[model samples]
Target: MALAFGLAWVLFSIWMSLPWLTDLGNLAHPLIALFVLTFIAYVPGFMNAFLLISLVLRPSSRRETPAQWPSITILIAAYQEEKLIGETLRSIAALEYPGKLEILVLDDGSRDGTAARTRDCQALFSALPNMELKLVREEHNRGKARVLNHGLELASHELIITIDADTRLEKGCITSLVEHLVASPPETVAIAGAVLVANHDESWITRVQQWDYFHGIAAVKRMQGMYYGTLVAQGAFSIYRKQAVIDAGGWPDTVGEDIVLTWSLLRQGLIVRHAEDAIAWTHAPETFTGLAKQRKRWARGMIEALAIHKPLLSMRKMRTMFIWWNLLFVSIDLTFTFAFLPGLVLAFLGIFWLAGPITLLVLPLAALWNLVIYRIQTRMLKRMGVKMEKSLSGFLLYAFIYPLLMQPVSVWGYFAELFGGKKQWN
Candidate 1:
C-alpha cells in the first residue's frame, strides 16, 4: 500500500508540475482548472494512504510494568464545567492504583457552580483510601497553562497527569502511563495517552470524531511513537515528569500548551512516548457550532505554537520534520476540500464530451478507494473491540461528509491565528 501511494504521489506531482496542466489556455479553462484541482485533491488522498500504511506497519508490544509505582498528582483544569465536573472527579477516584495519588481540581474562576460541584463530589473523591482531593480556585481566568502551572506547584508527586474537566480515564490509565515513565528512567519526560471520543453515540458530529480519533489521530500517534518523537501530548490526558516540566519552564502559555510543552521537552533532549493502551474517554462537541469552535481553537493554537517556535523549523532539528509533516497534512486537507466542488462541476461537464468508458473507469476507482479505507477502519475498530450502534451508513457519512464541512472552519482558524486572534478556552 505504501509503495502504491508513493508511486501515485510521484505521478500526481509530476502531472501538476506540467505547465500545460495548470495553464488556462492549454485546455478549456474549466477543464484546466479541474485538472489542477484534481491534482490538489490527490495530495491528501496520498498522504492519508501513507499514514494508514505507516500505522499498519508499525511495531507494537505488550504494556510493561515498573519495579516500583511512583506517586502521581492528577490535575483537572476546569472553567464553567459544573455539569461535567462530578463525572471527572468520580473517574479519578476510581483509578486502580496502589500508590499515593493526589487529585487537584483547579477551578479557573468559573462563574458557574464548578467549584461547588467539585465539593459536592467529595464523598466519591474520599471513597478511595489512597487518594486526596483538593480544590484550587483562581480569582481570574488565567487560561489552562497557568492553571496547570499552579497545580504543578501544589503537586506532591514526581509525575503530574493533566486531564481536562470533561475527560474520563479508563480503569488503569494512571498505572499504565506512570509505569512507562518509571521503566524508561530520565529519558522519558512525557507520555501521551490515547483519548477516545466519549459522546460518540450522541450525534453524527461526535460519531465522526470517534472515527477520526481512531484512524486519523491515533494512527499518526502510532507512527510518531516509532520515531520516538511524539509531537503532541493531548492536553486532555497526558503524564509529564514533574521535574522535566519544571526544567522546561512548566507549560508555556500558548494556544496549544500540549504541543508547545511536548516540543519544549524534546528540545531538552527528553523522549516523549505514546501509550496506546492508556486510554481516556473525552466528550466531543455535539453540534456543528461547538465542533467548529473546537476545531478553530485547535488549528489556531497549532499555528500559534509553530510561530512561537520558528527556530525549531531547522531541518537539523528532528522537530522540523514533524512540523513539516503536520503542515503538509493540514494543507492537503484544506486544498482538497476547497477544490472538490469545482472538480465535480468539471467532471459533470466532461461526462458529455468524454467517452462513457473513461467516466466508468474513473468513478468506480474513486469509490473503491473510499470503500477500501472504510473496510480497513471497520476491521481495525472491531479488532480493538469498539462497537458502533450505527452501521455502514454512519461510517460512510463520517468519512466523506464531515471533512468537507469541517475544512472551511479549520482554514478560518489558520487565518485567525495568522492575524493574532485569541482562542477562547470556554
Candidate 2:
C-alpha cells in the first residue's frame, strides 16, 4: 500500500512538473500545486490505513502458555496525586496476573498528603497474600524519570510495567500484555497497552479527544506494528523489560520518557510491541486550556527527544530502514505544521481564478477522503467494543477544526524547546 501510494505520488508530481501543465495558466499552476500537496499529505494517511487493514485481516498468533508468565513489578510515579493514588493502587492490586506482581508507588515530593495516602493504601493491601505494595517518598521534587528509576532500584521482577497515577487498568490487562512478550523473541523489550479515555463522557472536548485516540493515534499504532514496529508507546500505560531498560541506561529524564525509551530500545536492537488487548482507561483534559498545555508539552518533548537522538538519523549500523520510517513520520508532523496556510491560500486563489467547478470538486474530494478514513477508524473502534455516544457530526467537527487549531501550538512547542525550556513534571 505504501509502495502504491509512493508510486502514485511520484507519477502525479512528474505529471504536474510537465511543461504543458505549467503553460496552462496562473490558475493551472496553483491547481497543480494543490494536487502535489494533497498527495504528499495523503501518504501518511494511506500508510496508516494500509496498516490497520493488515492487522485486522491477520490471524492471531499469540502463545497460549500459562507457565511462561513472568513476574512483573508495577511502578506508579505520583506527584500531588492525592485524589487518585488510592484508586490507582486498588486497580493494580486487582489485576489477574498468574505470576507474582509487586506494586511500587513513588511520591515526588507532594506536600498534599500524597505519601500518607499511599502508605494507607499499602497497609490496606498488606493483607493480600503474594501481593506487596511499597511506597517510596522523596523529600525533594524530582522529575518522573528519576522517581521511576528510584523505584526500579527496588524492583524484584524482570518485567516492569509503568502506570500513571490517574490510569486504571482493566482486569486481565497484565496477562494480555505478558502473553505477547513470552510468545515473541527474547529481544522484545517494551510492550504498549491500549489506553481508552476514562473521561470520555465528561464533556464535548474529551469526547472529541477520545475519538482522536481511538481512531487516529491508536489506529496508526496498530498499523505501524504490522510493517516494522510500534513508533510511540504512550506513557500512561506501558510494560518494559527491566533488563532492556537498564541496558539502555534507564529512562531518560525527559518530558516524554515513553517516546525516548521506545527509540532508545529500538536503537539497541530490541523489539517494542503493541498489545491492543491490554486495555487501560485514562482521563483526558476536559477544558481547552488544559488540553493545549498537554499537547504543547507533548510537542516540546518530541522536539527535545529528536534533538538528543539526532545521531540515530545517520547511523548506518543500526536499523536504517526503521530510522528512515520514523524520520518520515516526523516529517509528516512538521509538514502539517506549515502546510495549512499555504494550502488555504492556493485553494482560495484556485476558486477565484480557475474554473469554479474544478475547485468545488477538489474540496469535496479532500473532505470525502477524510470521512472515509474516519468511518473505517470508527468501525474498528466499535469492533473493539468501545462505545460511542456522539454521532458522525461530532467527528466531522474534529476532523476539520482540531488539526488547524493544533498547528500553531505545535510550532510554538518546537521553538520553545530550542530556546531551553525545562520539561515540567506537574
For each candidate, how many residue pairs have backbone atoms clashing (under 3 Å)? 0, 0
Provide the lowest-lDDT 10-residue window in model 1: 352-361
Candidate 1, residues 1-426, lDDT tens digits: the string is: 564864586465446544534453344576644454444534444555555565556565345677667778999999999999899888887878878888999999999999999999888866677889999999999998899999999999988899999998877778878766665546888889988788887887887887777656776676676667788988899998899999999888877888888878776667888887677889999988999998888887778767766666664754456677767656655654555445455667863221112223233434454445456546645655655454355467766787677777888888888788866677
Instruction: Estimate the lDDT of model 2.
Output: 0.69
On the 0 to 100 scale, the lDDT of residue 144 in model 2 is: 91
Error of 2 at 387 (Å): 5.8
Task: Give the residue spans of candidate 1 off by over 4 A.
Answer: 1-42, 182-186, 317-320, 351-391
True-vs-predicted CA distance for residue 177, candidate 1, Å: 1.5
Residue pairs clashing, model 2: none
Lowest lDDT block of 10, candidate 2 = 352-361
Model 2 spans > 4 angstroms off? 9-61, 314-339, 345-394
RMSD of each: 4.2, 4.3
lDDT value for candidate 1?
0.73
Candidate lDDT (C-alpha), each:
0.73, 0.69
